[model samples]
Target: MTLPGLDLPALQPWFTAAVPGSGELRAELVHGGRSNLTYRLTDGTDTWVLRRPPLGALNPSAHDMGREYRVVAALAGTDVPVAPAVARCDDPAVLGVPFTVVGWVDGRVVRTADELDTLSAAEVQRCAFGLVEVLGRLHAVDPAAIGLADYGRAQGYLGRQIRRWNDQWARIATRDLPDIDTLHARLARTCPPEAGASIVHGDFRIDNTILDPADPGIVRALVDWEMATLGDPLADLGLHLAYADPAFDPVLGGKAAATSPRMPGREALARHYATATGRDPDALVEGLAFYVGLGYFKAAVIAEGIHARHVRGESVGRGYELVGGAVAPLAAAGIAALDGSG
Candidate 1:
């Protein structure tokens, strides 16, 4: 099917001109993601996935499509189940912004347990274990080997990130949400020690992956590299725990489905990651809190940004209202977790 909201006639010549072994590029929208634009492009005999920064995005460092391409390309021959990268176009003249193309991988991205209930228990375990193991491997990789040694600030990553998002909230603050600022201040004061620099998937949740049903737990392709970065590895683990934890507020935007209720939970996932990476989870709690709070704080800012975009007549839909509402509570939860209440 032809992709919606894309001008194929305008994009075709560019694809043919830059990428080889392609003819008659076709497009299709991949749904349910808000940060970046994703599309499946095919050329009758060849297929690829394209990702680019959102239209009119103000966060230049936040959405570096070229970095996504370079990082995924560097991991091409590794055991990580990343989609094979084809090419990247950094020139603004092509497709309005920088974009990268990777060969499409096949799998299902399950967001609810009903989807998993159909599968056998063993299969479910495989998917869960695979997710944990892959994360451990990701954390173990040396950034210098992949030409990403300078991906982020070499020191005080946590401190810099905390201040960055807090400033973002300050800039866009139109209402009196004391919780956001309170959390920021507390986290800044209790900033955890640097937990050794390594590659961290800023947002490492199950929804960002594609799982093969036949293999159940094994990820066929890990998607969404827009938030990938070089930072404290425990930060990635904490973000995973934040999303995997069973304590999220109920009624998640009328999705009305429990996606991770029985999937070994966050503690078990952490142990699995620890065992795989030979790291001690007990020693990483402080760092984890810092990262987890950062993750939630970042999520709130992103939701606010989306709300702002919606008010300006963007492509966002009403379903995002619930996402916007999650900001305050999630920020509060992060603070509590940092305060040793969670």
Candidate 2:
């Protein structure tokens, strides 16, 4: 079968040459990804995962294979659980776009409430705490020590993020959202000073991780590093909390495991992160609200981008139609978070 974004006949020789000992290849698109096009590839005996930018119009600085590969490659020996990076092809001549290949990891991805329900309540709580623990470990890793000191700018990260997402909004907005503009202005006005800088996973949540099937508390691998960068660690925490908002449900097709009522609330997760990272409780509680607001703004913009792609028939997934509905609610949530009502 011909895949939407892959040409198997053309890729066979390249994969064989790049990954020695690999035989003939077969590829299939992996669902649940709204941005990058992820493929599961195999040669009958060995398997690998390949990631590339989605087809059609591209967003500036988004869906970067090199960035994902570099960060995952550097994190191989760290405490962070990551799939083994195998090879990266930067020559667009090979696949019409840069792509990265990583060794396939065997684990379960609890993306929906139904999938999460298979685990016991205790397991669910453990899974939640496990995610928080892993995030703390990620924030503790020094960027410079991992040869990623230049991964992204740490200075003025909040301000730059505000500007960058605003630009992204302007480019992908299907409809004008005045609340988005208000949220942006509020974020700029209340942007907090960076407490410190570290390697922040642009997206950190249950669905983004591969959890051990037998033990949900064990995270096997942390995937999707396209947005990984050197930035305020709190931003990562904020985004994690933002994902827990019910407003995010539409983006994940209305049953996001992260938004499940069975899962721990945002306050619980935030407290766990603070305790795990040893941050001052009072300071984290205060600074975190702004980051949470920023997180919602970022998510809303991302949802709008996905909606735009769906409109242009560029998205390769089942739930793009529902993503557009998330933008307005998320923007309103951001405003509430900043106003101390969320």
Candidate 3:
């Protein structure tokens, strides 16, 4: 019998041909990130990471494996530590969908409070500051220098983000969420001008990156490029702060993967980013409400979508059952962020 989404018997030939001396392919799905399906593939001596859209229906732009490959490929020699891209397989006839493979990076993803506690206080501080520094470095990169000038429309990014998420809310909303509408209207009214364009990671935080297993403070590679695009850099910062909200823990079943108590405070993170980038912290703080509102709105919409899939019995996973309960809380958080209270 063939594996669920992969046909190893057929793929072994293609993989071996593309990557010489491969043998006895084996794959196990990597469970992290919300948008794309990822798997770790191994052939005894070597390992590779494969990424593709989740099985069944998917939002095309949200899971663009080719775009992920292209951006990561373009970042080959950049200061950003990314898993090196190996090859792209765009023919669905072979694997039922396009998939990208990258050299497997050896590292650990620290998420829980206990995990952070294990590291000395100094190490914990280092990991926390390291994350913000890396994010600042990413925002400082010039897209054209990396050949990603046309990655996405940089102008009017905030408006586009609002519209895009609002559309998603309409498609999968299971019930009425008045606060969602309230937050949307508020965010639209206060939408700030674009904060200059850069390569936005879409979802940036600690767990999204892999740390050196030995050193913990050093970042080996930044994974999960499903939502990567050229957009306002502040959007990434906002989302980073939003994810830090305790409300997000519900989506991950309480012990959220990136909530190590040792991590720097949200205010500290913003301050660090501002200092590193020479941006005015006061301006960033002033717009925090809008960005944070956008952040919570996006989270609520994504949770609703996952709940929609679960309702259809199309998605089965540990956190799927709990996602529906998260929307209301996130909506409240969004309003609070806008109110300068969250």
Best by lDDT: 2
- List runs of model 2 lying over 4 Å from the truth: none
TM-score of 1: 0.90
Instruction: Compare candidates 1 and 2 on lDDT and give the better one.
Output: 2
Q: In candidate 1, how many Å is residue 4 off?
A: 6.1
What does candidate 1's lDDT look like per residue over 90-154, in tens digits?
Answer: 87765677888888888887765576677677777777778879888887788888778887774
Off by over 4 Å in 1: 1-5, 245-259, 285-287, 316-318
Candidate 3 lDDT, 1-342, residue by residue in tens: 254566778778789888988888888767654556677899989999988776667753578888999988988788889999999998877788898999999998876656667788788778877887888888888889989999999999999999999998988789999999998998999898987889989878778899998887799998888888999888888888888776777565566646555577778888888988898987777777788789889889988887887787765335677778889989999999989998
How far off is residue 80 in model 2, in Å?
0.3
Instruction: Rank all candidate structures by their lDDT, best first, as comma-separated numbers.
Output: 2, 3, 1
The true-versus-predicted C-alpha distance at residue 68 of model 3, in Å, is: 0.9
TM-scores vs. true structure, each candidate: 0.90, 0.98, 0.95
**Could you give candidate 2's per-residue lDDT for residues 74-108 as a string of tens digits?**
99999999999999988888789999999999999
Candidate 1 Cα RMSD after full superposition onto the native fold (Å):
2.6
